[model samples]
Target: MKLFVYDHCPFCVRARIPFGLKDIPLDLGFQLNDDEETPIRMIGAKMLPILQDDGKYMGESLDIVHYLDALDGLPVFGGAPDPALVEWLEKWNDVINDLVIPRTPDPVYPEFATPEAIAYFTRKKTATFGDFDGLKARTPELIASLELGLEALVPLLPDAEGASINDILLFPVLRSLSVMDGIRYPAAVDAYRHRMAERSGVPLVSALRASC
Candidate 1:
């Protein structure tokens, strides 16, 4: 399998984490900037983290994760979670793409913000939520919403055993948010982070950081 991704895209990061956790060997193709031929050759869509297995191609990160999960014989939902629970997990995956990934940066150090990058983010931030102050003003509400989601999902997360797709899809959002100022949700985020720290997948995160 060949995985095409950029280093800092949170969607790509989320997709890659599960593969790392499962120890799935892949031929990684890293592309940081836009390539004219990539979209057409991969999925006919302008997105990172495109996965090619055999001759089949998939574009979205979640789709790629699902494909890899099936191939690796890993539980897509941790050990026979209810269908509704699985649906919710996939829903949250989309929510992460729409609501979280757009707002968060990859949680690595030596911030990758270039002048052009900053300008791009500035425009996107403004267009999405009006202005920086607007985004800041809504932080409390955002945190409250996230807390509610987390609280609702507490039952689905791993306890003494292991994490589900819920954890994989969820943690990076909080981790990415940790890098930002003025964003609160520390308790929920911290609990998840602490759990993630103790998981076997932690080394994968470490490897990813090292590679970056």
Candidate 2:
């Protein structure tokens, strides 16, 4: 089975988690930011982390996660996501996006390999996010907000015993934040991030330093 992904995408990271944790081998197709044709042809839209398996295609990150979790008749994410963690993410979603989205294309990921691809991403994202430079300038403020949120997240983090639906939902978002440096992660949350990274076999984004 092959999974087409944009490497910096948290949703793509979501789809990758199950395969990694389950010890399933998956071929990765890194889709370019400018390539709408590939996903459009596969799933009739320009969305991603599309999965191709035995001539069939699947879209949506969590759907792919659930399907893969059950593919071998044993499931890893059988429990519902922890409500506190879910609420924490919901509360901080905008802050996380503001900090992470502007930094994603800055890294040398395969999706942004070409100038056109980077331009396409920048243009599209700018429409929603205003200007990248404006966002970069607010990094200190954003990091402050994220650090507070991370502290609140500490008590909510699950123990590193088994996988839950929360792990699928939470790890990718944390991994995306790893792109930025200097935001202080609280002790439990920091350990949870590294633990989940190891368990999911998806390493944190380390290439780019914090833009602030």
Candidate 3:
């Protein structure tokens, strides 16, 4: 099976969680580039974390997460996830995503991004946000909201003995947020991130950070 992903994307991380838990040997389907036309022409959408199983195509990170869970017979919210918790997570994801795209300045792109991806990102983000400096200016208030979002999410975090969707879902988002200078998470949330990173069947996040 092949999973197309850009490691920086939290949604892509979501897809990886279930694949890791299922012990599936996944091949990289694509990386960030205009160089790859196959995903757009074939999958019909430009999105990270597209899963191609045999000749089948799957997109949407949460759906893919659910698909992986179903494939492995592991229920994320136990036998049936609490509907309210699901709604809450979706809301929190929106909160984290707001800050992630806007405030992540370009100075650090070379640390993990390819030149092509960085160029594409700079153009795309400039168009989307319109005023990068203003966005950067608002980051502190945004970060405060982000922390509150995590605080709300803490109750929904799983007590599962292994890699749970709860932790996997938030890991990359928090990781991305942490990249911004002067960002400091509350001690409790940082502790949670550590515990999630240590889960069984989960890949070492250091691999992604190994000078990507």
Question: Which candidate tops lDDT?
Answer: 2
Q: After superposition, how far is residue 79 of candidate 2 from its true place, in Å?
A: 3.7
* Candidate 3: Cα lDDT at 105: 36
Local accuracy of candidate 2 as per-residue lDDT tens digits, 25-116: 98999999999999999999999999999999999998999999998999878777888888998999999999988887853577887889
Per-candidate Cα lDDT values, in order, are: 0.57, 0.86, 0.62
| TM accuracy, model 1 | 0.61
lDDT of 3 by residue, 106-155 (tens): 43433235666666765777787655666667777877877676676666
Candidate 3 residue-pair clash tally: 0
Q: What TM-score would each prediction reach against the true structure?
A: 0.61, 0.94, 0.72
Off by over 4 Å in 3: 74-95, 103-113, 148-153, 160-169, 200-212
Q: Which candidate is the best by TM-score?
A: 2
Error of 2 at 182 (Å): 1.4
Sort by lDDT, best first: what order? Answer: 2, 3, 1
Model 1: how far residue 93 lies from native, Å: 11
In model 2, where do residues sit more than 4 Å from their true spots?
207-212
